[model samples]
Target: MGKAAIRIGTAMAALALAATGAPAVAGPQDAGGRAAPKTVAPLMGPRGVDALGHGRTLVTETGGTFSLVVERKHKPARVVPLGNLPTDFPPAISKGPHGTIYLLTGASGPPPEQRPSVLRGAAAPAPATTLFKWKRGWPAPKVVADISAYQKTDPDPWDQEGFPADSNPFGVLALDDGTVLVSDAAGNDLLRVWPKKGRIRTVARLMPRTVPVPAGLPDVPPPMGPLPPAGTPIVSEAVATSVTVGADGYWYVGELRGFPATPGTSQVWRIRPGSTNATCDPAHPRKGACKRYADGFTSITDLAAGPKGIYVLELSKKSWFAFEMGLPGAEEGGLFLVRDRGAMPRVRELAAGRLKNPGGVDVSDHVYVAGPLFGPGALLRLR
Candidate 1:
């Protein structure tokens, strides 16, 4: 969920969670009395969308514009100019104070354009990792946080993916408590920017799972066909990606468990009051404090707290990688709900096979979701 944000009914929750592999949820007609339409008209490269303060929808796109799109058809869009700002496309959005919009961005660079490493071998040049606060009356949007300045990456790590400055702050939230929550997907941590306190806290740290080389053959064709390489650590990284402060008054962070996607490895964490960076440990996850709230999401893209509870937007393991690499699978995207809190918080699917690589979701009147994101991806109302 660059992302989204609930749950209840224990035995019932468990039963619904068990339906994870079932087809997407279907219901009666939508507003305007339409048959649960498959998808809204497609937009361009989408990074995130959130239900605005006015109950309208705000969508972030890469072509240097942040737009407010009314969910209904024939409504004209209002564009916010991002002049030399947000660096790249804002990867996520959240509601802010007094009609303000918080745009969370990835480390500056063009949103991953999927340039084949075989060609453009150099890692794309990184930019000023930052968060922007946008609203009317300001000469320009304010850079609320210089995200890279706050990141303290692994002093020493085995992965050769370069340095700590590679922080991609994906999801963002501006809480009523005067704190800002940002998820650093590349850095693998949830950060709290306390402006007045003059401190940035690593509230939750997500560890990268080491998927050891199978003692068998490889799944994809090794470029070096004759000499098969040794067990390659599938370390694309499923670090902390999305975050939201739930209606329950606690904060939640979601993961996009790196490559070789472990079925149930991706998770959502609950952060309680008074919990510090060191306390919310996956090593010793404590229930209602820093515990895993939900599991088994394919690739948790964004999180939204809305009418149907907390909805998990899966980027769909297959389709996401299809453009990133060339691996193919069902590649179907979906939306799931966090069934309950406490340990092993269950998640149940609500919509499936309709989304592609959804990056952001805004839960409001119609439960609007955007993307299977790539090339201005489409928006759809969950039926």
Candidate 2:
């Protein structure tokens, strides 16, 4: 919370030439504002590879290595290297239903203590299995029936709140039957493992509880410099990043909250399944069930649901915010699509190339999207 408030949450939003559909010029627009006219949906991966269909795709390379994109139709089809992780580890890859591939690793460190480790690959490279582990503070889960033994221990014991070792296990999912969801933007929580029988759980814990800044909606800008002694905990107000699990099962959590230098404003929460504890005060006494469904978003990182519905990915300008899931708390829900902008024009067309620090995204039959590549460390894919 002090590196200039974590670089204004992650900084990277200052290029607005606007072009696509044209017609959004008020102020800060990037997370997908212009750039329309899109219809590239033939579906073809593995030619320089970026395919995330039913086959493979488990990229998470800040340098930690989790690369494995195999789908060769012509060129790019070889990156297999699923091992080394823990330098800036924020991997989240999921593709389960036969080919089975799940690699959820997030460890900015701290909490009960375990930190990050949950790798599993069913095909090529094979050897990468950790399952579960998290110590410093505890109580971080969103779904879990079992996860091999949860690495052995440190499930929560009775959290104390102090682990900020680095915290950054961004998102990971592999449902269909395998069941493994992990998202820990600094241990704000959301881990559920059940890889067979081992069992290990935390289910959900995105903090919440800060709500009160909604008078006119523009006041939080004052610390552009030195701040972080008051109470600390400013990892962009419980970071959270991205976590998807929706064909209807319900479990979409994406909170960037002032990232990459005030991208514009970020927020996205929707946890169904039972709803009660996201981390404290459901009525207190212990709390832990899960609640909070919708909220205005502006900086949401990545989240994709198939069937052609919920797809939210806003990396500070490269935009996307489509929704349509109502019935539980149904507040007149049913918007089919809000910012289609031509289905996805590389999120704002960013000079025609698009996607810079994208992150992670997964939509059933098509639409894949990855991140992490300032230069050589590739993982920049789009479907």
How do all models score by TM-score?
Answer: 0.74, 0.28
What is the clash count for each candidate, in the order shown? 22, 53
State model 2's lDDT.
0.41
Candidate 1, 238-280: lDDT as tens digits: 4677887677777788887654444455777777754666333
lDDT of 2 by residue, 117-191 (tens): 543421121112233322222322112222223323433322233333333445666667666676555545566
Worst 10 residues of 1 by lDDT: 1-10
Q: Pick the candidate with the highest TM-score.
A: 1
Off by over 4 Å in 1: 1-41, 53-55, 71-86, 111-127, 152-162, 195-199, 212-237, 279-283, 319-323, 341-344
Best by lDDT: 1
